[model samples]
Target: MDTRDTACPPTDSAPVQPKDFIRLIVEEDNRTGRWDGRVHTRFPPEPNGYLHLGHAKSICLNFGLAREYGGKCNLRFDDTNPLKESDEYVQSIQRDVTWMGFNWDGMYYASDYFEQLYQFAEQLILKGKAYVDSQTAEEIRTARGTLTEPGVNSPWRDRSVEENLDLFRRMRAGEFPDGAHVLRAKIDMAHPNIVMRDPTMYRIRHTPHHRTGNAWCIYPLYDYTHCISDSLEGITHSLCTLEFENNRALYDWVLDELDAYHPQQTEFARLNLTYTVLSKRRLIQLVEEGHVDGWDDPRLPTLSGVRRRGVPAAALRSFCEKIGLARCDNMVDIALLDHCIREELNATAPRAMAVLKPLKVTITNYPEEQVEWFDFPWHPEKPEMGTRPLPFSRTLWIEQDDFREDAPRKWFRLAPGKEVRLRYAYYITCTEVVKDDAGNVVELKCTYDPETKGGWSKDGRKVKGTLHWLSAAHAKTAEARLYDRLFLEENPMDKKRHGKEFLECLNPESLHILPSIFIEPALAEAAPGFVCQFERLAYFCVDTRHSAPGAPVFNRTATLKDSWAKTERAGLAGEG
Candidate 1:
């Protein structure tokens, strides 16, 4: 479990007429005294897998509305499908919602209302509103007509109420095999909306549920279980994504038939983020087939994945606010999300130095056995964050990419005979470059000026470049996992648009691991979930999943900015 404690950063106060349509509805409902001015919403997630980024938008909206209005929101698991659900997924959902910084007024499960939901189904049957269907699952799908056609009614649609009751009871008694029969609402066969064409309410499954162990053999479908559970809890508003717009009619049909308390089912467009896939089926395939690591892989879009990648809860909330709510679905640029993360981390994370690719530099003029300590501020702009002691010595490690043997006119970094300021230490001039047998730059020999003690000269001499380095003898070795976007295309899920399967569009270079790296000794003791900036590099966090007492693994959350964006601005060709 993550040890970081967080709160849902407070949203700005609501206005006279709210900007978004959903808020507008809530405002009008309050003014009209709907449900006696009580506002209640619920986040009902199916516990078949872990929550992903798409679900974050819904979680924020549902819980945020209740919070702003001083109402209540419930965290309910729609665990109707026992075959794919498990306790692991249920626990993960709870942890994620909490990590996102919101607590539920009440926690619940669809299984808790099984008896009441079953009774409601019987009530509909007694009123000639639903019946038992004997068709196979495929046959039922075939009969459910398309946009231009009418569906063929099931032969068992008109079964006597007494007979249907007996069959349904038998289903609960474990008298039928899986897929033997399904209980469906007897809606119009010729309805224009295909979802209303006699949808299934319950199906027989002999599998034991994670919660309600083998005492029964039947399970209710999601569409049927969701609305009834909301009504039973007296929810005033049932918020769902736009994909459920067509299902709204059926949601109302079930409650209206039972004469139960009905919550208005409002649908808004779901978040469609770029450069990754969020569909449950695709995510499951990615995990099950070993296309990625686990559910919490930083490259994945799952909330656990992003959290492990060092995305703060406050930044996610801010991103949600910037995007707001929309009636129509559109792709949101992932860059906006990166911007929010950078904004939050830059203000809070302390500054540190790390070398992903180390190249040794021996200061020829400095005493080999001597060591000095330099005072480095934790943050340049935030003086209150204070300072830490960093060791300076004769031998140190700098980034391999920082030095160029044949430097360009625009390059200010290290090169043969080039002088550069060592950050927080002294000025060094590279006099020699040593190469390995393969002609790779192995080491650099440099000389430091005694007068330039604190990275500056007593005389008014200026250096164009400054480089970050760590004392070779004092620095601790650790691993750095550099992570990037998981997909190459903006809309990876659009198979036709990409001319390949979604999996084929996956980014092969999403993750590059540097097995060994050097960081200042203080960073080795950083607690899991601690975030900081690697000066001149990127924003990183001590991985909560891998770091322990003395071992730390850092995950790069984002570069100073996208590498390409920086390259375009600098008008340079290679790494500097």
Candidate 2:
């Protein structure tokens, strides 16, 4: 039995709520008895690079649709180009999809159907539908004319079917060197859609495929391979991004001419995120040029990058659902993505205290050997999560930014002679600030109000500022990496219009590593990928790659402030 025959029903038991346009189309298809009320979709990603946030949208749509309609979604790798494709990328893509809480009904690769694809090319030639073109790539491009002008036919277009067949077989049998000849469809050169103007069906590439090895010297192009793969896999709804809208004509033409099982191709706008570059070519450039550490650099929009940056897979799925499907393209605010992460983390993440820039504070009146343990709730509103023991001692570590010698008008944080409530502890009044030879504030001398236990004053006198602190004796030293937008401009590629390279727009302050940050002792044994919120700081996760036993390295996920929420509030206020 086919493994794909075993269908896993949708996890949600609620009645189908067809909200998006894509879902609505599926609904209508089911209503009209299209393909006998069966729905099958596939996420066919080319394994040239790691999957990105943009790919997440397609994955959700395809798998979500399959689940919603009681069908199956196949995970297929469009591994046509061996030059840039690799098994490492294939594994990464699979890991990403699985991490996003999905399992493919069937797994396949375009290379798996190489023999069939070659035979199909011969079938096209026998029907006078395809021919071998000896023209160089540039010659073909020049002949393929502008959008307004019709393309000119290749001089080799009139090759007999026997000659075309022999060349195509030889091309596949490793007889021809790379780029010596290509198989082009014998479609109308004067076609309105430039993509249909005799598109190249196959090309000779001597590079060994990660899966197929050097068994074949020639490979079918994506335009030629994708449609056939879908048909062979019995895909009912072929969903892809709008960039392939032009190519859909060729998709249909090839299958129609060959009398193959043609699936309906639908196009939706691909995700274009603000403060991000999703183009695979640009992403490759970023990786090769060392703009990022690798494909998984937290600054990049790649799925592995975001995953490493501590973004929950659930948050990514929620973002995709919220963005929905649209026919036209638009730039989605990265803040919106951040909003989703913050929302999910705020509710689920355990709270701990971490001081990124530590400033020492000594409680002069407190006994040096005396230690008090206070129970602090993991989440203020979630008592079910219980609490962790927080140690309070004579000395504590506070955020350097929390202290201001020359305070602003509205500054309520620590200042000389000011009283502030330590989170879940007593109120403390700063007596004096100690500085080093360089005159930098090194330590603060403070006296705690013994009566103000549990951050509440018995006399009902309230302190204006509340600050987070860690007991110096019990705190664990850690490395905290803070990440910001990778690109300085909202549209990094837009710099090209202004005669500046996109690299020029790379943000210099994208990553900041503080090696000696202090966190609660409870976080010392935190395993890699463990996510938590640092009180008054940011949501963070143990770095999977760098964090180790006893010493944990944390990556700043997102800030507490929701810029997207603020934007929505401001828009509402403006309307009012």
Candidate 3:
């Protein structure tokens, strides 16, 4: 199936004021003097992997809400897991967020609060609210019973407060080996919420941290560290995905026990797109298994990948706004994303002529050494965009797909004995078809009608088809990459239902590279990252990483036709 045809059709209703449950809650909080009417939020991401579309939504929401309320938002790195976190991921995250046109008021790392976090842990032990557990990892998991049954109390749950404090301090001092002992909150073992059943507050990890190298051997777990970080920063609202809804109980318990400044936590549905997997684990696997080029491979859904593929940041922001915030999760059709990209590019991208699969055509009747410069508008409707000079001569190149020796019944494009307009030039008729030794039609000999200058017949004759072409003498060679959906299945991660491995659902033809493409000479000077529409082809961008000064490599962004619009039109026609 062509997944390109799959789309979540947009409604025709007029735009309404943006109001979601989270917004309503924020309004109520302001009315009730929550956090003293100060609005502060943070985008806390773990620096373990590059940010993806899912993170983009959170970034927009956190930053967007803060901006809407005239508040401040901080960029915080949840660098607690040093084993997997690195400086590369940190730099990429900052670059991605900045590229999305957001500036944080402050930047921080969770490791910066390690000293205070340890002090808070000691405070828990002294208050008899937390204790050091000597049980193995498996033992703790086994004791944390199923949803239907109460968990069993740990054998070391009754340790003396002084002993627990000494053990925790020793753990911090690097006197204990990894996993020898862990600090757990002294919450009820029989609590209905599993996350509150003596959750681990700190664990011994001898690994060196990227930011704070060899500073401490003990590290605070995410659940314990996140709340303290939020409270320490005086955040008014802690926004997170719905998976952490149960963890909210534990978050509240830690803050309440320590009597720290509390922040209200709100959960919203995360972005889940069809035919794509946003899980960091799955993405990492794809990279490690060589299923993709890298984190920024245009095929992957990573923000870097999407950016490298020439998706404008404005388009992404507009898409997030259109999707809005919802309480329940749903699979967003990838076509909507394509629609957003096409809609944005259609208004802004300049027009250029490119032949992906070139077929040579010789104007037999035109003068041999003559070269006419025809003016073409950069954007037809947008006259202010101006125009560029297009060279027309005896020899030219047209798209191979634009010609057919044995034409179909209503075909209007170039064929034997057929006359068509050469875009802004005169009308031309194919006089003879040139073939190679293997009978492959390699070229066409055409005769031009000089009376029909500038593509309009002076004698009131009508031409049904117009084709974009470039003077062979003035055209430049380029490399064009045609990219498509990375995954073939609508839900690549549906292993149980589909009975197929995620890798098995990978689309073999996701990327097609055309090494010998021709474009107009005006585009030869096009700099890296310059985007334009390739006439009858797709919207493309000059590859920033590969393009040189005099040569440009283009990456296909999206096709001109909107598949989602087609689907919608088909549905409406059926209803009629």
Candidate 4:
């Protein structure tokens, strides 16, 4: 996921205790010996789709707080919807959470509490706090009312407690079709908060659950299952996004009516990154409609997508740290995320030469069949990263964009008759340019200065430009994918404000494929998922899903440039 808040090395992130407001709250609670000085949190995600970058915020916050407070955090799958939830989503969620560098203290699913939840529903009916409602889905929505008006009472609102229990039990016994009847809390129909207006606790769905199979014909809704599951597990701080602020009341009402243990429901702003979408239904549509390759497509904001794109777990964590915590919603700049990515890769990724748009360069004065090797360091700043033997030959490849037949003023790259340093090798001056029948420049003929071997002149003649090159004889051709923001607009969702759909705002130039990229021979040893810098270019990772043995594909993780720092940036916010 593209993001601004996150951190590296889970160990580097722990500071005796992280000082966010949430952690401060935990600290204050501990000082008071609340809940006996115990802190328990949970990440309750609906397992219907792959977890996206927005989920990463909650993951880090919950997991990070648990680590700081010496408490435990559970990975709970709120699998309340059978039709949409599945084992595929369940496994993917686990993988994504682990990829983000967190291991849950307890792994569970709401389906595990199905029996207890059903019994609780029955108990509520026995006390007249809840009852079976025979209203159709449409009827219920209409009667639920809007913010300006209060909802009228349901026709069956006054059903006797015994009759409600019998109908609910029969509903669970497979006597009802889907949506024939529902179990709802018997709260006030005219309550100011519509969510607490007799919210449905259970609904009939004969469909088999991913984990429970056909063992259950009725399933509890999220609002009911969430609170009870928290109480049952003894969670002390039930953290949720600010959007769930309204549902907090419903969460408490159920637990209160049952007199069950209550967990404090605290809401924080959800992560919302620019130029990205995190809606599960919309994300699924993008995949199913062939808008993206799959859930792991590098262009997507999915954790798998970012992982495939070569975002390090540490970088994401570092981003979380940069974003910190916010009670109010904000739009975080994608540039800030790019800034973090570039910073992490610059320090860690091994540097290698690559020419995405290869322009052949032949040295006229150099001897044929002659080759020289330079002991090139993997990183210029850190000697500990070590070095590799870089091959140099008479014939070489440079980036086509690096050269200009008609050079611009102050251009520090290659041009005809201009001398420039060929990194790790000699200084070459362009003497000739060759073009195809279409008048497109295809090659350049240059003469290397023998005195400038090892990319330096004994006379100390400084060259402003330094270009990365690969020996034409040894360099391997690999595909390089350059990805950009998925949407041209900063907030794609805002397209609706213009009477248009978000899909129409797709950035057509989001992905560029250079299938004939030439890289340093040493890159042959780089395995899939190994991230490295294409010197003077973007940091790229070996594509894990599309690469084959002896042939690798590179996906651009981030550019070397930091737009956020170099320019005035705005709409800096987190995801929801």
Q: Where is the poorest 10-residue window by lDDT in model 2?
A: 1-10
In model 1, how large is the Cα lDDT of residue 96? 93
The sequence of per-residue lDDT tens digits that candidate 1 reaches over residues 44-147 is 99999999988888889999999999999999999898899999999999999999999999999999988888888888889888898989999999999889
Which whole-number lDDT from 0 to 100 does residue 241 have in model 3? 94
RMSD per candidate (Å) reads 5.4, 4.9, 3.7, 4.4
Q: List the residue pairs that clash in candidate 2.
A: none
lDDT of each: 0.90, 0.91, 0.91, 0.89
Tens digits of per-residue lDDT for model 4 on 239-272?
9998999999999888888999999998888888
lDDT head-to-head 1 vs 2, winner: 2
Off by over 4 Å in 4: 1-18, 568-576
Stretches of candidate 1 exceeding 4 Å from the true structure: 1-18, 562-576
The residue-by-residue lDDT of candidate 2 on 1-576, one tens digit each, is 011111234568865433667777788899999889899999999999999999999999999899988999999999999999999999999999999999999999999899999889889999999999999999999999998999999999999989999988888788888889999999899999999899999999988889988787888999999999999999999999999999999999999998999999999989998888999999999999887999888889999999998999999999998787888888888888999999899989999988999999999999999999999999999999999899999999999999999888788999998999998899999999999999999999999999999999999998789999999999999999999999888887886555668888888999999999998989999999999999888999999999889889999999999979898899889999
Worst 10 residues of 4 by lDDT: 1-10
